[model samples]
Target: MCVAHASGAPPSASTKAKSRPCPESPTPSSLRPMTRPAPPRSGSWTARPPCAAVLRSSATTQCKNLGPCTSGCAQGAKSSTDITYWPVALRAGVELRTRCRVREITVNADGMADGVWYYDEDGEEHHQRAEVVVLACNGVGTPRILLNSTSPEFPDSLANSSGLVGKNLMFHPVGFVQGLFEDRLDSHMGPQGCCMLSNEFYETDPERDFVRGYMMQIVRGGVWPWSTAMLGARSGTIPWGPGHHEAFARRFDHTANIGILCEDLPEEHNTVTLDPELVDSDGIPAPKITYTLSENSRAMLEHGVARAKEAMLAAGAIEVTGGGPARQAGWHLLGTARMGDDPETSVVNSWGRSHDVKNLFIVDGSIFVTSGGVNPTSTIQALALYIADTMKKNLANLFD
Candidate 1:
């Protein structure tokens, strides 16, 4: 397993592919009891009688574009850049620019946002005054924009009344373990990753020594015999060319491996700040992230390594190697402007609106209350939609 260091965030393990036989029936785990879709009526339960149970099944396992293929190994999903599906929004005349950079947000005397100041490629400054400003630049960019936008009314920084503009940063520690199996498993034919997950160790209890949960990245892929030889077998046991190919073929048939992905808790010390000395090519303050794995995160990694090794052994792996340590600067970057019920503790409300600035809203991973042991993209999208609904309904009150 190769652990690559990323800047500003930790990559999510959710993107990894899982290969398995397509089940004729829906998996029980896929059926979640959703809050029953209610009727449009504003009245109580009497106005909405429950309909028949909906079986939440996954879409057909075969790639629709590729004929009669049972394997979901083809690109998991695809979204076209053109012809966006949100037609209601397009008809509403939402203006979007391709490469506009907002340099700062201008505020009024009443502490309300008046307009946004941006610089285009020609170094020309432009302003777009609005009754409200919704900041959706996401984690790292969001904080950087806020810290850079300072006025006399907001001398310290825009919407930083709690002195927590760029703090409480967190990311995940990812590690991988690979094992050679015996048999002709044809790793390249199906999905290079796994379709099923073993969440046996997902929740960390007091009985366990770790403070956080570690997820497994099950994957199967092609590996040559020479690659295995260079990796070195268990206890320095080396095999010659033909012997190596035989062993690799045997292992590849039922080759099962797991990667470790552990969550990183928010720490005030792990922060993003403006490097006073370092400026980017744009002559703006570049974001300087000062962070390291916390004691809790380190403990989680150690616990994950142990658990992963055990799982490999249980799967009948003849050898397991390279499943340990947290790499530097992971990609799951979160926190900074965390939302909470209290204005004193958090920057945004549960609805993701600024407590101090009524007209300013932040909706992105920046407002994540906590980084759960899953990919944040789905959750972030859900939160954004939720906040957008809130804003649409309360626009009049918010602007006033």
Candidate 2:
């Protein structure tokens, strides 16, 4: 893995190390049961849930899986960015810097992206000039950097003439629906990221309380023994003390899970602002993310949870336990610097070019117009590639 750009929001670093073992293929054998398509609904009988390819790895394998791919594909089989584009870019001689944090985007009197100022590991500041700047520091980091780059001429923020740089931040609200089985499904035996998904209710129905919908995926919800035992106790399913051992023994291998990825709308109030009082070690202002689920999201969650329970029951699970919207995990942050035709309403144009700085481009989830219910990485990558192609054609005009 080689990291070229590092975010300034938190204690972060880049790496240029090689990964061990190949990521288990997306169709790992252990994941078949999880990957099998959910049946179509026959009303009362209920259909097999639709499958979502949101797995950190493609497939699920039992003990063969070192752990869930999210933890660190110990088996070396996760389709991560490091193993993908980095190799090609490196082979082509793109310098890969580790532990370099971009302090701010520098602009010239021409009001174009001139380059970036950054800090080395020793806290030494350095400036790197560039003909153009492409911001991909993620939803929070991108906006945080842009907001911090307030020059005398652009007091509001660079690339933020509409005052929308850090606004409309979004995260796909998630809820877990766990099912307890009488027999040991050995749920802990496979990849933890979800394998199967149901999209019966994916589309928006005017009759439903929400507008956009959500997705449900089958998850291992399995952690290593310690985490599993601890989470069991925390959820109050397993008792503490002498009974803890026995309770843990029974529950460890007998669980199945369904997880919800609710569609979150772009809301101005859900924003990423720079903290007035906090700063990172590099002396850059830290990010202050403010988010709240709307009524529509809550209602969508309610519907998803209900459907999750029904799915579990149909699968022959003895009991189901779960709830709405995961708060700790903000895996997908998007829409802060949206791409649209209207400069008055967006930060970047449709091709991700800044309306204020034509040479500056953004090609990340931050350019998303809407938050889809599934993992956004595939879409994020697709957009990045598209932007690269567009940049190839417009490179001559990029800095003009």
Candidate 3:
């Protein structure tokens, strides 16, 4: 994996000209050893830059690249919001509350959000009142909270007059294609995923069977010994009595993956609802997800898989194997409570303010109108910042 310097300096013009060709680009034969390339500013495709958290430098804290990034970074180098933003918020006098599970957003007699009802760590119920309420929960959680907050003023739920709060749940349906190389690539040395990105098929192509396209993310495949052995056993690649060691050796450290992130269109049938029979430890209703891939998404995924196989073969892969709509790839949750201009169509307005409850604001993925074919973290942050700025500018008439 390539590492970027912590100085945050742009590469020189000469370096830019020498950047590696994207694996899925027209010149797939030009694929070379992974090098530190300047991140693309704006383009259909480019080599993915090293994540800011993984940059190594004496001047800054960095990731040790110990590999299980999903389980929390022990080196504190993963720039999670809790490590990067919470401290600043704390310094700014933001009270950091933990171990409190919010159950519902309590509403006033006039149908305004007052605060929330929550269960503390000790399982004690508490109502924290506030003049204005904000919901930062993700697509599923936000709708669950709102749907549970029923009152006579808005008996259906808080800010749910449009009846679209838990409707239209969307997810980025991903497909995985793994290529086995002949030589060791040390592919698992750094961040587990995101070595390169290709958007060659990102836009809607009228000639294609799918309406929207997918983003191809070239990723490193980790060869954790135990996991590798388990996988090989399940796939019948490694035998139990004989040749197990030989098979494991051949399979390890020589694999790469291309992830296909398909754009999911909002569908009213794909929804989030409060489970009538299920509840958490505190007896709060749990969120029940109802989702299925649209035909367009399925077509897009099939096309993406075919293209991924072509790219792998072009890049000199000895073998490539994988398939679409990975059941466990519903990571990008969005569009449960979408934003729009009309109250009859969306739960929130353009500024993330609830259409029904003037004082209630949502700064999360739930307000997204569409699920773009990419990770939504940066966009979520940008939306939050924009909503914050809008609130600041309209403080005088914020709740009007």
Candidate 4:
């Protein structure tokens, strides 16, 4: 159930260091006894500095002219079904288990998988002789699992004769704008958001600067000072206290925020390799991600921001701001064990079956041919359903 949006490693010590009070901590008198400012929001943007000068000031970050900041999407917007479907399937006799990392898939002389060997959480060796095995682990995990699963006949990894196991990782490079307004915007409290969506620039064929198109999203609430600082907000003469709160409230009341998500082209360099020196608590090597912001991504982000600002101003934003220099954003992984008709060029068939192992299947974001311009969870669920149906039709052939 880990969706496209749920990506990346835990924050490192360096990334977490920014949480120390930024000269902006509330005064001792203003501090509530047990309350603390919400832990600075985490994930991709959490690694940056918190000073307004470093990020951006709260004022300009919460402008009304800024289209929806966090309001366009429903606060409760979620894929609940995706979360529980597999477990529900398990209860209905689908046979699900975890912590059992595959070590090898025993293949018949005919190049078909007959069973798999793995280690349990206790490091106990065991085997699952199955007519079929499916790999639904996300993009990065799937490739590692495949490469780790070496066998005698195949010599290389299972279904990896083509040598295209781990390549082409992708995610959207996102940017946002926050602006200050003259009214209380109620930045928080509602279902995270539910407001505006602009696809005006979703698909641009122009070879101008960027290789991909970007989409815009808006939220009703204004941006927080810490978040602004991360986005390059500057410090100002604005005083803090009741005046600050009042100013923030007024701005929040009128504020709307806009965000742009542009496509990042898939490249072999953005790879996920195993860390030989550092293993996880389970003793499995941790996945080491090596990513860099490509020029194509940079161009898309810059152009997307310019287009977003223009739209915000047209939509009644009193002020418009831009964000950028696009970092190596994570999440939305795809094209690791890519799919193709030719077994020599890909890992799985169009139906996500291992070409060398008819009894094995891989159904997840890992098999994507191309990472499209949308949150991939919806499509992932649709694909799971499609693969499940394919399994049903081929169930008899699988065991034979």
Best by lDDT: 3
The per-prediction tally of clashing pairs is 21, 17, 0, 44
The lDDT of each candidate is 0.59, 0.73, 0.75, 0.57
Residue 62, model 1: Cα distance from true site in angstroms:
7.2
Model 1 scores worst on lDDT over the 10 consecutive residues at 44-53
Give the alpha carbon lDDT tens digit for every residue of 46-105 in model 1: 111011111222321222222111232233221111222233355689666656778778
Q: Which residue runs of candidate 2 sit more than 4 Å off their true CA positions?
A: 1-67, 74-76
Residue runs of model 4 more than 4 Å from their true location after superposition: 1-78, 82-87, 95-110, 114-126, 183-195, 219-255, 325-328
Whole-model lDDT, model 2: 0.73
The root-mean-square deviation over C-alpha atoms between each candidate and the true structure, in angstroms, is 11.5, 8.4, 6.1, 14.1
Cα lDDT of model 2 by residue, 1-400, tens digit: 0111211011112233233322222443323333333332422221121112223333422234445455555544444555445666787999988899998999888787889999998999999999879899989989998998878767778899788999999899888888777766656654665455566677889999889888777777555788787789889988888789888887786777778888789999999999999999998999998988899999998988888887776666677898887666588989999988999999998788998998889989898878888767657766776788888998677655
Arrange candidates, best lDDT first: 3, 2, 1, 4
What is the TM-score ranking, best to worst? 3, 2, 1, 4
Model 4: per-residue lDDT, tens digit, 20-138?
33332121111111022211111111111111111222212211222222333222122243233544566679765667776556777777777877788788878888667778778
**Which scores higher on TM-score, 3 or 4?**
3
Tell me how candidate 3 scores on lDDT: 0.75
- In Å, residue 314's CA in model 1 sits off its true spot by 2.5
* Cα TM-score of candidate 4: 0.68
